[model samples]
Target chain A: METPTYNTAFAELEELVAQIEDKDIQLDTLAEKVKRAKELIKYCEEKLRGIERDIEEVG
Target chain B: MPTPKKLSELVNEIDATIRNRFVGQAFWIKAEITDVKKQPDKRWCFLKFIEKDRNLITTEMGGVFWSNSYNQMENFEAATRQQFASGLEITCLVKVVFHKRFGMRLEVMEIDFAYEVGKLENERKQILERLVKEGIAVNPEGSSRYYTQNNTLEMPMVFERIALIASANTDGYRDFRKVIENNKYGYHFSVTDFSTQIQGDAASALIVERLHSIYKLKEQFDIVVIVRGGGSDTDFKSFNDFELAKAVALFPVPILTGIGHDRNTSITDLMARQHKTPTEVATFVIDYNGDFENAVMQLHDRILVTSERLIDRARRSLDTYKRIIASSSPETIMNRGFAIIRSNGKIVVDAKDIAVGAEIETIMKQDTILSTVTQKQDNGNTNI
Candidate 1:
């Protein structure tokens, strides 16, 4: 699979999170979507954390 | 007298004579036609009359009106000031017949037009007033307070398997079933009508019987429709009881009421999730579900569009990042005659990888350089 773009991956992560949170989503589909959302969240969080640490160290 | 037949024959003859004495006699007695149904031969008017219930048991009698009597009563009721329903009390002259095989029957002959009154309606209204006072029949404003909690619908498309809490075999049950099935979305309906008598002493019992059955199979339907033909409020008073009201309110699914009466709202109606004046709860069902379906579809569409847009944004950004990475690739740098060099199998930076007496190598864009180390330096202090 092609690696996701730095910016686009975060956007997809947000989208997946939103889908999980939406109340109207079917109950049966919640678990799988939530798992995917967590993975995306971690991926996005890792990227953001690295940037945060770099900024802190430079300052 | 001497030529009279055996005792059995004489007794049977007397019984026949007594029955014939009242067969065609015209007399007026007060009554109301609770159910007026058209049959193949003639219209059958189900009649009910209270005879003071001598033992305090409210008595009811059925009267069949073939044709002439039906027309008369129809016209009389239409022209009269009082309603011709269950709670309606009226004065009429009925030709009472004691059929040898069919027991007592009444053939209404003449209606005392001036005798019709508002006694039944008033009684029913008074009962309603009492129920209201008892806090059982809550007004609309008061009812709204009970709905302050959040109520989001879980099931999207509810399977409507209706059990019409009506009698086993009656036109009231059949007519109710027909009217509900008349609409377009009628194809998916599964209505099992327990045919029941509309108005009589048996009326309340039959209603409770049907209600019991529907309540038993509560999981099969989202709501139960208790429907009957338009008739006396008294005929359907079983629906107004606190027991029935509680049954409906506490039912697994919501109970819907289509019990007939345009102007009068029963305690059952107040307890139900929805109420319609006539025997067409499907109208309310269709409208309610239609609104629900529309909202769900809108939300579903929103989910799809938003997901697609997000995924698309992700894909486009990935494409741009790939392009930048490809531009800075090792093959591109090598083709430009630049090289990544190492000395003694390690990348050369500050020449530390070179040992004082060892051979060193360098990789250039086009060639390799080999040399022997002849100098040593520590923190810029050199020994040569």
Candidate 2:
């Protein structure tokens, strides 16, 4: 699978928050959902922090 | 018709008559240059001068810049940074000379620098007017100079991939690279150089070609940047080209110009999405990325805070349920001074539930006691 973009990661975070806020969520998976949300947040934060990209030259 | 004169004799007579009338005379005249060529291994140049009525050439004359006067041509180019080539209009001092074989020619003496500059300025005005008339740009009003389709394009939210149009040798290109590479925010971008000449007569065509190349792969770029080193005002002449300006104005992707002039804005600059010095353009990109990062970080913070609040609320709710369950236990109720009476195997809550002679067990927090029901009492209350 392709790596998620920052926008996509943020979107996933929002969805997770919705699930967490809803009373219908099972308590059994609450911790697991929170952990996944934190992971997505980290992924987005890393993307923002700079990674070097190759500089290409063309005619 | 009358006794035909020999060709040489007629030419000599004509030349003598020409010299007799205008010998040792110099005149300042306005003419357009054409077919200019420098003699090989010699400090002399030959060219043609023409006078035009509208676009039609009315008169033409051969002209020369002798070795002694060549420095004047050099000085003109130095001052204007414009090529002293064909199509250039100049007010120049010339001496009319006539020879039997060469016929009539003018020896160029001096060129008017201000006149050439004025001509260029006039052309610039015409180009700007044409752009507005053609609906390519809005008429600049007040402080706003240009409003074009390209300028109206929305910049990408993140400038990660860039198509860079600039000469590889220019200091502007180096400065831009240094700034972007060393940015404090460490925002990295994929800059692809579409190297091309940034000045001279052919620069506009080369740049326009580069823009075309970028168009083919438009999806790969977030924006296109054009930059050149700082130089004389005339050094930025190509950027004022109408064709280049039109290309920039109509480009599908946003373009940025950093031609390095503070006093004058080129037509390309007016049409582009942003115009700044090379270093400043780099800085702007960095800042743009920084802003996006800040927004993302803020969103991260919000999500973190909200999720924590949700988990904390869940925990508190669980704690409340635990307390309620513990407090509602039978032992807890009995500890608060209530006894549970059991008849046989069931708890008795009403006087009618027990017979007059039935045996009962009373359960309390600390002890259980066996007892017998001696009588039945009638009371209005029946609910336990």
- Writing each residue's lDDT as its tens digit, candidate 2 over B1-384 gives 699989999888888888888888899999899999977369899999998889999999999999988978877876665667898888999999987777789999999988877877788889988999999999657755789999999888899998999999778899888898999987888999999988778999999999999999999999899988655445567988999999999999998888886766778888885556899899988999999999988987786666556545544544443344345445566889988787887766667778888999988888999988787766657875
Candidate 1 lDDT over B75-140, as tens digits, reads: 655544233555555677777666555656676766665554254345555655665566555445
When summed lDDT is taken over every stretch of 10 residues in candidate 2 chain B, the lowest stretch is: B317-326
Off by over 4 Å in 2: A1-59, B1-28, B33-86, B92-118, B140-143, B231-233, B344-346, B365-370, B375-384
Q: What is every candidate's alpha-carbon RMSD to the true fold?
A: 15.0, 11.7
lDDT (0-100) at residue B52 of candidate 1?
Answer: 50
Question: Model 2 reaches what TM-score against the true structure?
Answer: 0.65
Q: Write the per-residue lDDT of candidate 1 for residues A1-59, one digit (tens) a residue.
A: 24566577767755655564565655345545555545554565566556555544643
